[model samples]
Target: MSQNLGLRLCLVVLLCLSGCNAFNGGSTETASITPAGVPTDDPNATRGLAPGLTNHGVVDSIALGDAHEAVLSNTSFTIHGKTTVKYSNGTLRRQGERTARVVNPRDRRYINVSIYTQNKIRSDQKSTNNSFWSNGERVLVALSSSQTNSTTYQHFESRDPQYPILKYHPQKERYYTLFQAVDTKVINHTTNNGTTLYRLTSTEIADSAQLIEYSMNVKIAQNPRNLTFHAVIDSRGVVHEYRLAYTATLTETNPSTSVRVVSTTRYTKMGSTTVDRPSWYAKANNTTPEPPTTYS
Candidate 1:
């Protein structure tokens, strides 16, 4: 297939994978485990013991370290990632960053915006409903903006979001997949608004190979060194916030490079969020889709 056509086809697949109104995103959000099966053994009761070693009933039931996508669709959320490479002498070699904010995900009318930059160069991205950036041009799919608004979705340009475990975890589009194949320990636990929250941590224990297979200059994803993952999740297995960072040394370059990757995600205003139409689409926009009062 030609390069242009290939790019277009890739876009189509990604659109479907991203939970388009027609596709229901990817895997339907699984129902949260009921209260009966939920363990009520509070970790806070055993305050004398060390934090991470104590197995809170809540953590085991939810398998906090697993790759489970919380049911937060149609909610307002922001995800960001930054990858930087520098020479051993501390000179910047390359850097890439990407960010996205979704107003009402999986709705017909929405404002989902994303920006990707590599070494200060930005890619051609636009904030329009039912459209895509196809090889530097905006191509609108027939997805109705008034009916089932499918927003243009783009992956991070700074890094491939790739890992060594492909077959075991194929859904790279979902940022949470980066946490797969690891173990987590409850470092802290608390309650707010009658919701139980647990703060967890992990370090360099992910099941990955010693070397990244097809890494760019900043080779860290597959085999992150000194990996630090901090997750704040609720009782129902919902992640409210997460931060992960790791460092690596790249010897492929002349001076030998140091690499660092930091990723952060936050979910807010779920189930009542409203997306403002992009100025470009606001004039043509006749209707805006409001998030459902409740989501799975």
Candidate 2:
């Protein structure tokens, strides 16, 4: 594979292993508040929350039926975010921004994603753009080449569910097992519309053993470091924002290299957004469809 492709693959793998998202631009009304029915001083208060808690009965008792369902049941939503990766010495390596739109009505699901990388900008006012579209089991992807000013399309039948979207559903056992809340706090947040939301903050960590159990391919020079996650869930059980960060040394090379990656995702205007079929779908053919590639 080419160097650029290799680097892209590595980044994709890293972001997948580290759960990512956090909303920005929300107003903060108060520094802290205590959640009802849960003791702030007790570290075990969040023992049965989805995405962390193992006790099913306790999860049902909470105001939020299922944290993931709020996201899954919505017919339309949009996620815009950026991820940055840095080397051991704090030098920038790779950075990219991604936007995804998901529309699910009845049993049919549609998703469109566009990713832009900072490294592939050309002087001719051209740039590399990779995009993906999926409708249920059918998938189409387009990769633009700066050198040729042409785009290549790959169509295929995807038996595996689309990622990041599929991964966002916290009801899945694998997804739930990836996080354990270490701290729970409440904060008063005011939205742009002046609506105040009682947000519960959960600080979570996933250790090396948990990562291995999840079958995440993470290479580390020494013991794997824990992945830190912070989420802000409103009183209504909606996860308005989430952020993930991790740093580790890779031992696969002769001399280990240290790497750090951080990503943030936000959800807004839920239940009102719309995602339509891509215009390029009409031009795609599946005669020699290639396997789908996952990018976070």
Candidate 3:
């Protein structure tokens, strides 16, 4: 009788473990658009922004409360854009374009992003067709299950850390914290195709300690140079474009060289984009799942 009871207990524990796996496992549903305007394949579809909401309304809501959290939680959209980074001498160092979908406005972890390089490459060589997605716990590459560091994931997930790829999703806390040591202002405004654009600018003087906190690879002298920012927002309160210009003295090598770097990004295709789940996700549902550490 004791042996039979022990067997029953083991079976019960196995059943509970199976249930937990089913709950935490990544989904494998086919991507489908519903009549209700929700994308069925999106894990966060049930938590998406209200249907037919306008950019203007989103902006007003953000301004009325916690700007970053409110905008991130209440806005959902698709955006595609290009980013160019140049050296102080105006030489282009890198340029790339990315397309992304945010099915759930409140949580950036539910986003899907695809990226490509602008420079032409040989067909035989693998092109930069990088893709990323988040499965609730953390971000993962579309075809792989390996975990990615937050900073690296944030780089491709949002592209520009200073100005997240989400048009209205500002990094308010980071901005405010940095601004305490800098000067910022609304430099100007312009109108185009019924949309008004406001330009905001900021400048900061920093030392090695401040630069280190930002995770920069290079070292700089005390009171190095200046770091400047310029962002343009549309009438509906969406960021149309942003640029960051930084100058500092390098401390990594001899002679302590001064360097300047500039990065610029532009956003487009805001409200009408959708991303399909990867094919592997569907396959995983029918078969035994590989360990989470597995990579494609």
Instruction: Say which candidate scores most in lDDT.
Output: 2
- Clashes by residue pair, model 3: 72-105, 73-106
lDDT, candidate 2, 1-296, per-residue tens: 26336435644543444332222323312223344444445567556344422222113323343554555565566655455556678866545454556666522334333333334234222235566666656766566656477877666677342333433332334334433312334433344343234444443333455544332344443344555555555434555555556565656646877667565556554677665667777665544665566756
Worst 10 residues of 2 by lDDT: 52-61
**Predictions ranked by TM-score, top down?**
2, 1, 3
| TM-score, cand. 2 | 0.59
Residue-level lDDT of model 3, residues 171-242, one tens digit each, is 343333333333434444555665555555666543334432332332333343567765555444454454
Any runs in candidate 2 off by more than 4 Å, and if so which?
Answer: 1-66, 95-97, 106-128, 135-138, 145-149, 155-175, 181-184, 187-208, 211-216, 221-229, 285-296
TM-score per candidate, chains pooled? 0.50, 0.59, 0.46
Give the local distance difference test score of model 3. 0.37
Q: Candidate 1 lDDT, tens digit per residue, 1-296?
A: 25334434433332222212111112323223232222337655443222122333222322432323335442454333333334446655443332233443332222222222223234222222232211111211222222224432332121111211101111223433334434566655666777666666677444443212212322323334677766666765665555555566666545655665444445445555544434444323333322222213
Go through the candidates in order and give each one's C-alpha lDDT. 0.37, 0.48, 0.37
Model 1: colliding residue pairs: 19-25, 108-148, 108-149
lDDT of 3 at 134: 41
Name model 3 segments beyond 4 Å from true. 1-65, 78-99, 105-130, 135-170, 190-196, 202-228, 234-240, 265-267, 278-296
Q: Model 2 Cα displacement at 152 (Å)?
A: 0.9
